[model samples]
Target: MAHTIDISVVPPPLKSDWNPPAPSGNSVSPLVERRLLPAGPAYLAHVKRAVHKLTFEEHDKHVEAENERLGLNGTGANGEDDLGVGDEEEPEDLLTLDAKEWKKQDHYAVLGLSHLRYKATDDQIKIAHRKKVLKHHPDKKAGIAGDSNDDGFFKCIQKAMEVLTNPERRRQFDSVDPHYEDLESEVPTEKQIKNTKDPQFFFKNFAPVFEREARFSRKQPVPMLGAYDASKQEVEGFYDFWYNFDSWRSFEYLDKEINEGSDNRDDKRYTEKKNKSERARRKKEDTARLRGIVDLALAADPRIKRIKQEEKEAREAKKKGKTGAANGLSAKQKEEEEKKKAKEEAKRKEEEDTIARAEAKKAKAAAANAAKKARRAARATEDGTPA
Candidate 1:
């Protein structure tokens, strides 16, 4: 039995008489009609409706097959011992289920959160979902089995992500806007709800939300690689904190203190000893690694050996006040000198501009005051007031 499905027909917009591109390839009935192209957004609508129809058809076949398998089609009717498979008409297909039945399995309720009765920030919804998932995840607890555990939690997360990310589905489901509007009204077309039940949708939706959260929330600066120089103290500090475990431990303690209402840990000596030993070990390892690399490179190249010998000889000559053509300045010294000069010039210009602006502002104020006094005196004489 096919239930009466209310399929509202929306006409093409009146402003432009554009036709959709004809369905391509060999086919009996071209899936999309060419008449509905002008309304570009509704193109997705047409596709979704087609998909829904196909899904319903497939579901109808499945129900019929199941009924046959269960002997519900009178195959073993009337006193036949059919092993309790019950010779009754198959329960109505999914399409036959009324709106009330559909409401029982609402996608929003599955997420363990209230359906939106009003607008809310995505963060609020996300927090609610996280709490719900944590409560329901069996791995986090114990003894719970089947759908109430990880599987159900994951399904709910997926559904919520799908419904929220798609503007059309959310608006329609939330009753903020009707799925079908007045045919001739100025109602904009919606993107059709996709039929994907895949987990990939969750990740795709999650990335956008994650990016939004990271962008708006003030986060500790992340250190980037290749930032090396005097001008990058903050960058170096960011990396230093990031690479050190103490920063992470401190953050964890702070979070615990905020949430749990206390922070009292008395084990200090052991922690200090452990941290100091770890740092010393790491530094020693790094030094050995660098030294091994240098030794390997020098053994592989005779030029490095000659260069070191020449450098040592040059330093000795310089100490003895014997100068040569290649001895004016080293690259490192020149770079440092240039940096110092630039810093001094920048500071000098800043101070000069500061004084200049201050003096100009003082002069302008004095001139304005003198002009105001003259205007007041002229006004007093003109009105024959006491002057």
Candidate 2:
């Protein structure tokens, strides 16, 4: 007799309903395209999906526990209240109180100025912020405000300052702010109208302030290539733009070479890749070298002999200037000043030598002319009986 065998049915694991957002068009950099594309988009997408799944799972667990504790059966969890649950059946008004507290602490509303105002004049805002800090700094108000633990409030202030100061970050913050929602319903101010409508007017009003803050932060200004006219008068900033391109291209080429090893020795594709890689590497090194040179020049490149001379001079000058030489003339400064002075002296001496050569040539020419004239006169006297 044949025995009947039973097979247990196994089901496939559940597929994730969630999908990661597509990469923004601007997110793809040329460097990324060249170097990272070979790694494959699927690998990146897989990692992103895994992370999202994990995050969603955690959020779901937290929400389920919160709902169970709150006794809000069948109600969806909305992140409206920080205190998600109450011990007993809580009044609806208590739920609203938490939301009210959150609303009261709206950072954007406290700093009621528009994005344009902040962007147009960061210094003025900074000054205003400094004043507000002095006035509302939890430490200063601790005795009156009754909150001895004011660190959280101070932290909030700092966070607000940081957000408002950054352009991209401020734009993001403005978009999410309750005030942004109200802006559409409210009448636009004359200043707001002008900023929105007139690009030139806006730039004129804001660029100086933005530039000043950027300079203070030690940032380089954005280049405007089209603004320059080569056909007109000599451009002041042409060399800077040229150097920037050189530095960027060289760096790009060098980096590629380092990361991607050389293997295809005879291939045109390989050669181009190698060229790009080396160029990038060399550019970085050159930029670093240039920065070092600038620092050395600033320190007044000094020689040992010049350093001794400068130290001696500084001591003498200090006596007359009424400044303390011991404090003023550090070893580094003395060396730098000496080297600078030596270089200047060498240049001066070279110029003097050139001048002396020119003068000697003129004198020799004059003497030669006189000698030739004398010789000719003597010859005429010898030839003629009229001597």
TM-score winner among the candidates?
2
Instruction: Estimate the TM-score of every prediction.
Output: 0.18, 0.20
What digit string (tens of lDDT, one per residue) describes model 2 on residues 222-293?
Answer: 432222123222222422442343321112212222235646556657667777766656546645644443
Candidate 2's C-alpha runs over 4 A off are 1-108, 112-120, 144-151, 185-387
Residue 98 shift from truth in candidate 2, angstroms: 10
- Give lDDT tens digits, candidate 1, residues 271-378: 555666665564465345334433332243233344567779889988766444335556668889999999999999999999999999999999999999999999
Please estimate how well model 1 matches the true structure, expressed as its whole-model Cα lDDT.
0.46
Q: What is the Cα-based TM-score of model 2?
A: 0.20
lDDT top scorer: 2
Candidate 2: count of backbone clashes, pairs at least 3 residues apart or interchain: 14
